[model samples]
Target: MARPGPRDGALRPARRRTVELVLVLTALGAFALCLAMAGLQIDGRVPERFPLYVGVVSAAALGLHVTLRLVAPWADPLPLPLATLLNGVGLTVIWGLHHVRGTDTNEADRQLAWTVIGTVLCCAVLLVVRRPQRLQRYPYLAAAGGLVLILLPMLPVIGIEVFGARRWIGIGDFTVQPSEFASILLIVFLAAYLGLKREVLGTAARQLRLGRVKIFSLPRMRDLGPMTAAWGVAILLLVGTRDLGTSLVLFSVFLAMLYTATGRKSWVGIGLAMFSVGATAAYLMFWHVRQRVAIWLDPFGPDVYTEHGGSYQLVQGLFALADGGLFGTGFGQGRASEIFASDSDLILISIGEKLGLTGLVAVILSLLLLAERGFRIALGSRDVFTKLMLTGFAFLLAFQVFVVLGGVTRLIPLTGLTTPFLAAGGSSLIANWIGLGLWLRVSDSARRPAVLPLPTPAEHATVTMRLSGAHTRAAENGRNGEVSSNTRATPQG
Candidate 1:
């Protein structure tokens, strides 16, 4: 065989960053329009800091795009643009609500600052974690770090209770939600561990059989250790901090990634069973859980709505949603501000109130598209670790959205999980952006073409000599065949 030329198997830059840039610019334009609409409808003019907001968002977005080009040129483009749009929507709603409430909440400025911080952190992740496989080396360390972060809010001095959930820790004026960051770390640990142990965990010792056909596979009892550990962590969070959202998010993502890693339906069933038991126990044991369930079940009841920390806010959110109807009341024109935690926990309601079902669906679709892109990256990846990590990351985003939407819609009991990139929490925003960075980092590695090293001069010479010898043998065989054919033709006559 002939040796491959220099261009053979060469790495080609996909240069998808050009496409990404176009998408980013379009998102920025849409955001600017939304901001303008938000300000004009409420205050009868564009926002006073309209240019400033647009400039900041544009800079942050373009800066991220350039960073991707420099570091992760092959990374997926959709997430950044989607994130920018969602974050921009959050800022618009927050700023719009400030005027609606007639208060001096500097939330928009704070959110802008956090957006800068999140974008910087995102860039830092891309720059730092060049090789995601390196993460597979320290699964235990990541797990330990995640556990500590999850448990940090339980500590006395630094820990602070807000709205009856002890999920935030404070350093003087700076309050951070450790669980938000910890969730990613936990996913990392799970992805690495399961990627390594998948063969063992995914192996089914027992199979339910029907005559000649094998029906379903069952998980081994011993393989239950990791599953049980995840369940324990979730139960600990649920009971210890009383933050239903964080616990639910962490555990559900674990189960999803577990099923993904193992491809075992039994694991999902077991996880659901365990979650039900844990939730029931918590509901029976903890008043907070019971209260949330009561509010969800009967938000309009006088006994529930009139009680302190009852369903007043939930009812208000419902009312706000009802007011918006099919089409929204227009940006900055709804009564969502009257609902408690409208910018944070009830953000979906605020979005529904201002933008209505169509706009809400648009936001939901953006999130779904982002998650789908992550899943697509996972599918395109070659390495198991990369695939698992990307799957976990994608599951977290999708599951978190479901949980938030479920809670707001009363499909599930409300919990204190902020909408990723769309909620007003700095820690949540920063942590999610960092997750996006990880996704891009792993994606670059996954999609970037693998380059094979060229052979040395001696090796090349050896291959060339071998090819020459083969050609010489082929020439000799051809000569022999021609002579035989010429001689045999006379014999036929």
Candidate 2:
């Protein structure tokens, strides 16, 4: 057990950090491109003040991100880049809207400030949580904390009801969605529990034969203790505050995690059945749920409120999206001015309108690419904890994207979850970065030597070529000894 020499410990991180720095620089370049397009849309006169300030702040934040990432190179990769892109788009859209409205500083200023705070917070999480496996130490506590956060606004002492839902818990000038933070905590608990319980749950269920195929025991009854409890909490939240979006998103997240942990299609079938029953019951018992269903069914239906009513946000969002057509109205020239409340949940619609179908498709493609990369990292990593965490992180991003886009397009009832890292929300911005940090850690782990103890110096020299990020020795060792490391070219400079 020789300690890693100072040089040995520092060199790899330094090299990887160079990669992280390159990533930040690329982000700055993206922001610059967006600003240039924005300036062009504004008659070649960039909002001299706001764009410049945003550029500086964004670059500085990205620099800090790179530095912290060097310290924890194994953190989540997709979350940070995805967050940067979405947040960048959010700022651009907000800036464009401000220009159209003749605002002085632009709404992007606030978002930029939040981004800084979020990046710092993400760094803090990496510093505190050295490993993902330790999170299992308090799964029930985390779940309870999530429940409290979701139920915080229900208390009469400090709740403010807005737009017919009491989702926000304000602390002075800052408004925080307790549920947003709670969702991640809940996911952590679910992953920890499911990972530990998978074998028991998988083995307990009795196999059943129905018609053509046989199904092994699905953990429905064994899982009912937890699943029923989650359902009860969700229904309670919906009953008390009527936050349909959060409830739906939370349910789907846990359900997906369950299937992934067990690798059982029966769980998926059971989940769908339970969800169908829940939806029917919810629609019958709650007028708000019924109204949401109606809107999703027909966004333009007359029975629903219009212009000055509940349909206003979606209507305006649809208009902006339709207005963009294909290539978008050349960046900032689109007519999104009429869409009130366009920058938050429905920002994608604004982007669809302004960036056009190409932009919309590109955004979706980017997220899919991110999800794919994350799963690759998870699959490559040797540690089961890292694998599960990265897989869950990918699931979180995939589901969030699906939920938000589905809502905006009238494909599903709109949920309140802010588009991860893109929408204007402090909790989401920070949480998304934390997710990315975890993924980065897992991916880093994947790149390391896989087998146990390192051999003597003589043996090491034999594989020196393979040690340099290329498995030249592993290939040479074909029919030789056990291959300890799986190497691929990673930029060392």
Candidate 3:
């Protein structure tokens, strides 16, 4: 068999920018249509801000697209478009709810402002980081920052407790969910630390055996510190904020990065066991946890539905979903506003109510595609830290989405997790956009072609003679300064 020439190794042209532009345009069109349909359904006329809304969203998306072209031309094209579509859908739902409730809050306008801010932050991340692996240099610092952010909501002056969960910090009239940003930072720290220590945790471990079969690998006692610390942090989150959702998310992402780094099923089993124990303890100790469990079990019961901290929101969301049927009630229709938090935690229910089962499926599929692209980037990455970072981010999105959708649909106890890209929160939007930027940077590195160094003419001649075994004794002797050769010299081993 013949080896291929240099032409065979040439890199293919990157079509990322073109693909991204088309998808962005499509997303913009869909958003415009959603707004127009809502306006027509509500008042038999288009909304006055329809064009302006489209223009603003398009400009924001275009700015990000252009930034990618300049800094990360080989980045995956799917995430940006998928995120744009989800954000647009979220805006449409917020707009529909505002109109239906006849509220003067201008939620849609506020969301648009957040979208602009998030996009700018996304661009800033790309410009500053340029290389994802650079983050590994400050793992401890990242972890500390994450811990501080998570605990910020517990501060006396800034902490804002809403609906029994103390998860946000208030600056005058503005509120920010610190946990959202904290989750990403924590994942960054986990990826770096786990990637650096995977070999010891994976191989330098004792094997647990049953008869002749090895059941699982257990890390050394000394190696157990990181996992124990993570578990402790999760429990602290649950205890401090009464926020079971963020605790679960943080712990789940840690478990995922650990597993990715080690390639061991044992880590997953151990992580789940720890989570089960923690959840049980939480259920026993916290009234909120028990209430959430009760709500999940029987939200429709009169006692449960009407009691303080009962399942009123959950039941309303279920009813809204039931009303939408298969094809939904169409845009600007349905009673989504009847449910509280319809634009945030219950955004999916709002979407299901107005767009029905079909649109709901489409939205879910888009999220899955975004996740798929992130996983693809992880798979292609050659650097361990980069791979783990991408994997952790993907798992974060997956778990957060599952928790939100499952809670709304009664598959699990309701938790205070917001749907990514589709939920109405500035903190979540900024965090997700930053995550996207990191993924893009990693993907660019993974997809870029490797360049091989070329040999000089004399070196090439030496290599040829060495491969041909054509060196005479004099030439071999000349290598040690015993003689000299004028024709050619053989390469040394």
Candidate 4:
């Protein structure tokens, strides 16, 4: 038989890889179908460069699968497919919006380009970070980098003010949301810090008492440094940048990870309480915060709706959803293009309007599944840092979805936060893809089969002597079978 080439070996279709291929194809087909539906509903024809959209989606999806197989072969297959489906949904929405508005195709094309960039970065992370546990070594460095990212938008010359929030920075003609990437770095720092201190924070706390009745144990003040720092960071975001969304997300994710590490439910309550105080202070202090709350309370109000940059987007988004009801308005049949900021903060509203409640639920369920898979991956990991880091990514994503969806649905006050994998922001997409890469890395480690190490040089010498002795004895006596099995040593190649 001829030898198998290295290329053939790399391209081998194992069981999980096969499953991934089927799912990726399924996701791509669904997106193509949606694209076609949008085209026919709007312009009474197939979309311009229809095959190109499908091709891009297919290439990105397949490329991710191949990368996973080559680098993180033991990773769970579901995440890649799940994220691809969500990304496809976003692309379909973007396409529908552009077509209905009769805008140039560059916006969606720009989004597609961003998707490719994000995927490439994701693959790069997988290639670079072989042993994710090593990330624990640079908690401070991660913290510094994260702080810089979030704060960069506050710089006068570089910062770009969109509406009132200053959470973005200008790079030539492009604007980047620094907080999106900042969240991941902060999560990395939190994971590393909590991994080291979980035992002490969980079990070594001093118990508190209310006279006769015992209250909860109090964590030592020194032990509470990370918590305080996280709280300060959240408050700074809220107060400095007027970014309620990022502040809430960053703080809430940290709290969830903290509770997971410590197994202390009280920490959640404490974190919420602290966050509430900050929120109230911001509401009292910042007019933008007050306006958001007011709009959330009554989006249909005449005064608020008519006001500049008020509830027009929210009201329009709600009306679009009402139009969607059970089934959707059917692709491009509705006026999603009329809704302001429909691509980012209102992307869910776009889904709700076009795909209707049923499709909306499907998308939300996809988010839930992705988060579930991430948590499950964290649980499968043996290392504490891996567990916390995976949990942070999963929780951050889940909380982000919650906040954005709630805002769109009027369940909570709206703020500026992009949907992961399903929004049009390049920085957010790239950051999330990077996080997804980390998830795959840790999952691969968790799922990889246990491999025993070869003997050390000293142990190898001892084993060699035993083997030689047994062989000589058996040969001299001409009784190989008579050699004691215990005395025989087999040295592995």
Candidate 5:
């Protein structure tokens, strides 16, 4: 037989190449815009520092992309590229905020350096995680590690307290939030746990009888135990540590992932019940949560908060958002960065104020696209573990987006959580990049062809015999009578 030509081997489906090119270009465009906006924002205000920083970060991100293309050409076509662009945009916004505040650019420099470090880490994950099934071997260990990380910030005096929340652990000159990495670890645990329990959860039994109605056994209760534990931790964080928004978002993340895994309505009901209980408890015990509830209920009411009481940040966020109106004040032309800590957690309002509703919608749409593509990756995957893992990651992104955007717009009470990829945080950037990398790996597996073992002599003989029988049957039919009733009744045709 003539060998297949190199061109035949090289020819890939056009759709894959198109997706790859589109993502690459989109990432470049977003990165370029971010650089332009940052430079424009810092014009004559700073000592010409951000330009070099943006240059270095941009180069590093591009280099990572090139390396991935060379090393894993079939990888998920979207996540890493989109993450790079979002990270660039985040850095640019942070740099702009620094310029406006006249603060030192050292933080901005550190952020850029971390971006490089995080990109390297992402590459490492891509290289290390060669298979999806490998993660299922150590669920307990992963879950324990995640729990330890969440509790680390509460250890002695080593943990740093910021904004009344002990979510960070300061190491040397760098501060890291263990909760961010912990979230990823917990996600892995959830995927493994839920994937295994999905069958059990799918089976239903009667629990109680009332008249003609009987209560179906919470078959999903087995699956809900870990999530309930997660909810308890989140509630503790909300009431004790005053981080209500993160807790709410985390609950949503777990619920969303669970829903995707089993498509169970009962899980949603259980999550909602837990959320309601948590919210009521939080409102009763925590002054901050109570105050937030008040602000959320009556944000625009007369004298809603006493000057700097509860509604100050929401008030300010609203003012900035309203000021942006429709078309916005133009890039680098808003007053959002003048507010304290605006660049890190409240950067969305800053972007809204400068770029107007158009920019805000653009960012939201981009995130939606990212989440949609992530879910697409998950759905396309044949491996159950990969599907669950990818879906869980996508759930995290969607939940985070809803939390931050809802908070900024006062659709929900404001939380201090930073936006993923777009907000300035070392832990968040690192974790998000690692996640995007894993997503890429899953997507690659979805697209790549599996290698089949070559047939043995016996197998070859079987195949030959089947083909020979088919030929002999056809010849016999041609030589003998035409199609009979039995042949007509056959299903092959």
Candidate 6:
């Protein structure tokens, strides 16, 4: 039997889009099921608005999926479906909470609107960012833009103080968290800058030795300028806005990217040491930081729980989670709304109370899958900038989830970071969707097949003539007993 040629191998089916469509449908179905269950639990029947809500969500998901098919056909199929599922689940949870509590505020409606806006913004990002590497051209510009965005909320005219954190800019009854967008831009700058400077940063300027054995390699003080500057900026932002979550996330992402770019463990150690010291100092000097630490330590204490701006919400969250055992109270049956900011800062608790340990694990696993896909994209990427950027994004998502979940579970002090797709916030939703779009773009590039250049007609004719000449020479040699010395081998050029 004859073996198949390279063309046959290249002709394999491109079923990425088909797989994506199937996953999208599954996600939509799961979302609709969640909504239905919530409605049944709340009203003992499917809510009248259930069909309308599902239609809106289906249209949004289909629109985004179609956009991906058109713009990034070769992209990884998992991130979109995972994001859609998470977003849909979040909407269902918010809707259940709002109706169950009989709250006057239309938070669920606002979240729905934001979801639509976020989906549109995600599509826009796909259209604008046709290639991921193009972002590398303006590292400085991105850095400047990121810094400006991070600091925009400090402006007295527009800055709005909420829950004692000045992290939002008010615009005609709407608030925007500039740091959410700033984080991505900063990652872009870091990826580009670190990709270009990895060699220098990786080099060991000094070696620590003990008894003729090298202990470790340390970068030069001069080489540490960038890291120090970044640290200072993070500290300044934290102090200026008193937003520990944004500061921690931004610095963590930078450190992750720096370590990834240079493969230097020293950088990690240095970053951790710096953060620990800064955190200690902040805890000692800042009342808010001290209060947060106190709440983390003694959330159940009478004095701590009842104090103004105390751990009431945190304690309530714990009660709700504890009330939910293995399987939970079920959708729309838990009193999660007793906790303030239940849909935003305490969304994880809301999920925990309604869905229990099993559901929480599923949500976390979904996020992990998304992060894994991103890391896989980074691994497959050929460009250094693309790899670093994707790595930064993966770390960002991982760190954000860790901070939010840890705070909810009392593993860490509350940092006011919203859970990515599950939290109710327009800025976070839009920014994350935009990040997802970029991930799709990178995945498409990484998975795309390399195009081989075809041979020109002139080159093909030359090869044909050479073959004919060789054949003629062989025939002549056979006829004349190889007496072709005068032919000079046709120069064989």
lDDT of 5 by residue, 370-480 (tens): 899899999999877778888888888888888888877778877778888888778988888888878877877777666556778898899999999999999998766
Per-model CA lDDT versus the true structure: 0.87, 0.71, 0.87, 0.86, 0.75, 0.87
Q: Give the higher-lDDT candidate: 4 or 6.
A: 6
Candidate 1 local lDDT, 1-493, one digit each (tens): 3454455342343447887888899999989999999878988899889999999989999999999988888788788899999999999888888878888748889999999999999999999999988998999999999999999999988889877789989988889999888988888898899898988999998998899798778888998898898889889987779887888888888888888888888888888999989988988998878888999998998778873568888787888988888879986567788777899988889999899888899999999999999999999888888888889889889998998888888898888788889989899999989999998898888777666667888998999999999999999999999999998888553
- Candidate 5 clashing pairs, residues 3+ apart or interchain: none
Model 2: lowest-lDDT 10 consecutive positions = 482-491
Give candidate 5 misplaced runs (Cα > 4 Å): 1-9, 13-22, 41-47, 207-228, 236-240, 300-309, 456-493
For model 3 the local lDDT of residue 324 reads 92
lDDT of 2 by residue, 36-148 (tens): 68777875766575556566557645765665565666443444555566667777777777777777644677777777777776666666666656777898898889889
- After superposition on all C-alphas, the RMSD of every candidate to the true structure, in Å, is 3.6, 11.5, 6.1, 7.0, 6.5, 4.7
User: Model 4 over residues 1-493: C-alpha lDDT tens digits?
Assistant: 2343334343334777888889888988888888888889888899887988889878987998899888888788899989888988998898788777878878789889888988888899999999999999999999999999999988999988776789999999999988888888888899999999888877636667799787776776677777777788899887778888888888888888999999986677778888999999998998888999999998888878963478988888888999999999977577678888787779999999898999999999999999999999999999999999999999988988988988988999998788889988788888888899999889888877665566788988999999999999878776645565534665657
User: What's the alpha carbon RMSD for model 4?
Assistant: 7.0
Off by over 4 Å in 1: 1-15, 209-216, 465-493
Better of 2 and 4 by lDDT: 4
Of candidates 5 and 4, the better by lDDT = 4
Q: How good is model 6 by TM-score?
A: 0.92
Instruction: Return the lDDT, model 4, position 324.
Output: 93
**Model 2: how large is the Cα RMSD against the reference?**
11.5
For all predicted structures, in order, the TM-scores are 0.91, 0.83, 0.90, 0.90, 0.84, 0.92
